[model samples]
Target: MLDINHIAKTFNPGTITEKKALVDADLHLQDGDFVTVIGGNGAGKSTMLNAVAGVFPVDRGNIVIDGEDVTDLSEHRRARLLGRVFQDPMTGTAAAMTIEENMALANRRGKHRSPFRWGITQKERSMFRDELARLGLGLENRMQAKVGLLSGGQRQALTLLMATLQKPQLLLLDEHTAALDPKTAAKVLHLTRELIQDHHLTAMMVTHNMKDALQYGNRIIMMHEGRVIVDVEPEMKASLRVENLLEMFEHTSGGKLDNDRMLLS
Candidate 1:
């Protein structure tokens, strides 16, 4: 579970270039809640996740994870409990490491177990094979290959497996499929839904694809100018349409979406 209360963040405060990224933004996620977020440029989507991930300290307010206040924790400290997959395919895994090595690192993330194992134990190896096999990507056979040799889609799948291997307290995915080809993106999304359901994982995904946001998740949230402008559950508006979401964005934010970067990018 996650709770963010009255959080605010500003960059270059009190200067000519001061940009307010977050303005009293608040959000809550119950255990196993899979919420998809969509917004135009500078809607504070990533800023919100960055605050929770401790990538940067929030200017104000509290962040609690399942009752523990982590507002003041360092990024490395918070990482022990948070699993994140970034927008860039190049960010999550060590490209030089073999697929199995990358996976083993993730499995040992928060543990204080034996620190000198150069290779996976027989049991751990079997577990890794089983997990990779679920993706149906033939990665189980390519475990000895370097991760850098994998295609973007395959790498993303491997990252997903790594993130869940430790059974993280929360999963944060930031536009994870933005860089993949459409066909590959769909494959990754399918895997995402499968893994979330299989593990009963609580996840918050920041996405630009409106259709993807609407199609997936139990809930959808639209953000504008650093605050949630619209939040709806599937049951609340089974008839919701894409046009309606755009209309709501213009309404609650008091500004038409004119950013070509958002509308046409």
Candidate 2:
């Protein structure tokens, strides 16, 4: 579970270029609640995610995860509690490392480590192979292959597996599929849904793709001007269409969606 209480953040607060990234932003995620977030540029989608991830401190309010107050925690301290996949496929894994090596690192996350003790056991290698096989990307057979040799889609998929290997308390997906082609994006999305459902993981995803937002999550939230403008629950969200969401955005935000960056499909 996650709780964000009236958190506010501003960049360059007193300067002429000051930008308010968050304004009393409030959000709560029940255990296993997968919520999809949608908005155009500067809507604070990524900013809000970073706040929860402790990329930077909020100017106001508290962030609590699983009943612990983590607003004051550093990013490295919070890393153990979250599994994150960024928009860039290359951000999550060590490209030079072999697939098995990358997975071994993820498995050991949040644990004490020493340079003297860094060998992968046969059992751990077997586990890694099984997990990779499930992706249907044939990566299981390529465990010894360098991650840098993988395609964008393959790399992103591997990143997903690495992120969830430890079964994090919450999963944060910031347009994880954004950089892939349509077919690859859809495949990753499908894999995302499978992983979340199978693990009963709670997740928050920020996406520009309207269809992906509505199609995947149990709930959909729209942000405008650094505030959550629309939150559609499961029942209502299931029947909502792109046009309907656009109307709701205009109604609640008092402005039309003039940005071309947000995909309506």
Candidate 3:
């Protein structure tokens, strides 16, 4: 469902602050594959996700989603093909909008909007209620409440629901649960797995938590210096421990894992 073909990206070219974010990074996902990404700081994990999402044009290579080459497509143009949940709960939803209002916007993603179709219809409200009810957080009862009033975990859960409202071809999760408390993060991660599996969606999740990475996905990939250094398939990943992953990184990258947040987590 997704193919990243030897993509590379550099920021502030020819300048003092120039940095190559992705170097020949390549990954392919089957229609229902859920892959977890792990890396230390500046390992090009988020860079690769942004590149695939077309946040900026890559200097070289192509990004294909569902067999369509979208390397040159603008970020908004790629929205129809991808659903994204960011690290910050505040980033995904409008604070001032009511729960249903925010969902209405998500439901219309990538479609042409008509000024005449301004209000939510009864059928649309019913659908939103059903979707919210699946969160099991009683958000269905708070459909009229402003999103700003929600707790961090609640808002994040709502954002996840909104992202998958239309089932985009690919889902990009960029450390989505990083900001939540451990208990909340665990709940969100569980919901994430259920949502992905239930919809049979293709997904790529960038996470700092090593155990979460290994425990959540069928495949795991590590990155270092803008390249994918290790990709553990299901057979290997099932037998692997966090310590094993650390050893693999040291052996492959010739450097010890230095990210404290990743290790301590």
Candidate 4:
């Protein structure tokens, strides 16, 4: 459902700050394929996701989603095909808006909004409540509460629900659980897996945790210096351990893993 062909992105080209975020990176994801991305700092993991999301135009190559070429499409245009959860919990939703209000905006994503019809209907409210209840966080009762008042984990969970409310062609999770405590992170991760599997959604999750990269997704890809060096399929990933992944990285990238956060995770 997603194809990235020979994509490359170089920031501030011809300048001293030139950084090659992606170098001829290529990847393909079938429908319902959930892939976890792991790499050290500046490994182009998030860059590839942003490129697919059209955050910025790539220097070269094409990106096709569901058979539609979106390489030249703007970020807002691509929003119709993508549901993204950022690394920061606060990035996805309006803090001042009520929970139901935030959900209403997500539900209307990519649709023409008429100012004449701006209020949430009772039916939509009921649907939002039901969806919030599925999170098991008691947010259904607090639909009228401000999103800013919720905890980090609660906000992230709500963001996840909103992102998948209409099931985009692809879901981009940029370390959506990185800021939460371990327990809360696990809860959000579990919710992530459940939602993706239940809806048969295609997803790419960028994570620093090796165990998480191995445990949550059907396939795993490791990047280094802007290139995808290792792509492990489901069959091989199922039998691999954390140490095995580290060894693979060293062998393929020709260097030891150096990210402290990744190592500790």
Candidate 5:
């Protein structure tokens, strides 16, 4: 349902500070394909997502969603077509808004402006309650509670829920669980798996964790130096061990594995 063709991006072009973030990058996603991406600091994993999101215009390329060409579309235009969750748990939700209030905003997204009531309509309120209840966080009872009062894990969970409220054409998760503790991260990941499968949504998750990368999606793509280096299916990825990934990384990146792997390990 998504197609990226010959995309390229560079920061500070022609200056000493110039960095080519993506070069001839291309990717395609089926209607419900779930893809997990992994790479070190400058592998262009996040750049690919940002490029698709129109955070910054690519120097060249085309972005098509379903069947429409969105290459010239601004970020706001693309926003309605895609849902994104950043690495920072703080980025996705409005802290001051109540749980139901935040959800109300998401629910009404991409609609014509009206003086319609904000917090929750009678029908939507009930649906929100039921959905939040499914998270098992008792958030259904805390509808009026400010999102800021919730923990990081809780907020991320809510972010995940909100992003999917309208079923965007695509979902972009950029290192979504990197900040949480192990247990909390696991919980969020499990919730993520459940939600993605339940909705049969097309998603791309960029992560630093190798094990999680292997265990989650139907496909995995490893990036290095602004391009995709390895794209493997779940069966092939399942046969891969961390050592194999490290070796593959070195071959693709043309350098020794950085200390980040050691630190993460």
Candidate 6:
């Protein structure tokens, strides 16, 4: 469960370069709630995610996750409570590390560190293999291969696995599949759905693809000008088509849909 209460953030405030990223932004996710967030560029999509992740202190707001108020906590302090998969495949995992090695590192995340020892045990390797096999990407067989050798989709899938390995209280996916080709993106998205369901994880996914937004989540939220403009529940979102979403966006935000990428999608 997560709650973002009346959060507002502005960068370079009181200056010519000042930009208001989030204004009176409030969102809440119940246990196992998978919410898809869609908005055009500069719509505060990533800003909201980063704010929850504690990428920077929100100027005004309290973020609570599973009953803990983490608004003042440092990013590293909150990292233990949240799992994030970035847009870039290269961002999450160590390139030179073998798939198994990377997983070993992820497995130890959020745990108390001990400086005395290191090495993957047989049980961990077995668990990692079982988990990798679930992705059906043949990563189980390539456990010993360096992660740098994996394709973008493969790497993203593996990163997804890594992010959920600890079953964090919330999962933040920031346009994670955007960089992959369409076919590969679909595979990664499928894997994402499978993992979230299998773990009963609460998640927020930011996406530019309208169809993907409507097709995947239990709820869909449209953001505009730093605020959540439209929030649709499962039943409503299920019956709604892309054109309907566009119409809602125009009506609610009172601005034309200026995102060409979203339109083309």
lDDT of 1 by residue, 1-265 (tens): 8999989999999999999999989888889988998887888999999999999899899999988999999999998888899878887999999988888889888687653365588887889999999999999999889999999999999998898887778899999998999899889999999989998888999888877877788888887888877888758655777788788888888887644534653
Which pairs of residues collide in candidate 2?
none
Question: Where is model 2 more than 4 Å wrong at Cα?
Answer: none
Model 4 CA deviation exceeding 4 Å by range: 115-118
Q: Model 2, 24-60: lDDT tens per residue?
A: 7888888999999988788899999999999999999
Q: What TM-score does candidate 3 get on C-alpha atoms?
A: 0.98
**On a 0 to 100 scale, what is the lDDT of residue 3 in model 1?**
97
lDDT digits (tens) for residues 123-172 of candidate 6 = 88899999999998888999889999999899999999999999988999
lDDT of 4 by residue, 148-263 (tens): 99999999999999999998999999999999999999999999999998888999999999999989999999999888899999889899999999999999998998888898
Candidate 1 segments exceeding 4 Å error: 114-118, 258-262
**Per-candidate count of clashing residue pairs (backbone under 3 Å):** 0, 0, 0, 0, 0, 0
What's each prediction's TM-score? 0.95, 0.97, 0.98, 0.98, 0.94, 0.97
C-alpha lDDT (0 to 100) for residue 235 of candidate 5: 69
What TM-score does structure 6 among the candidates reach? 0.97
Stretches of candidate 3 above 4 Å error?
A: 115-118
By lDDT, the best candidate is 4
* Cα-lDDT of candidate 1: 0.87
Query: How many clashes show up in model 5?
Result: 0
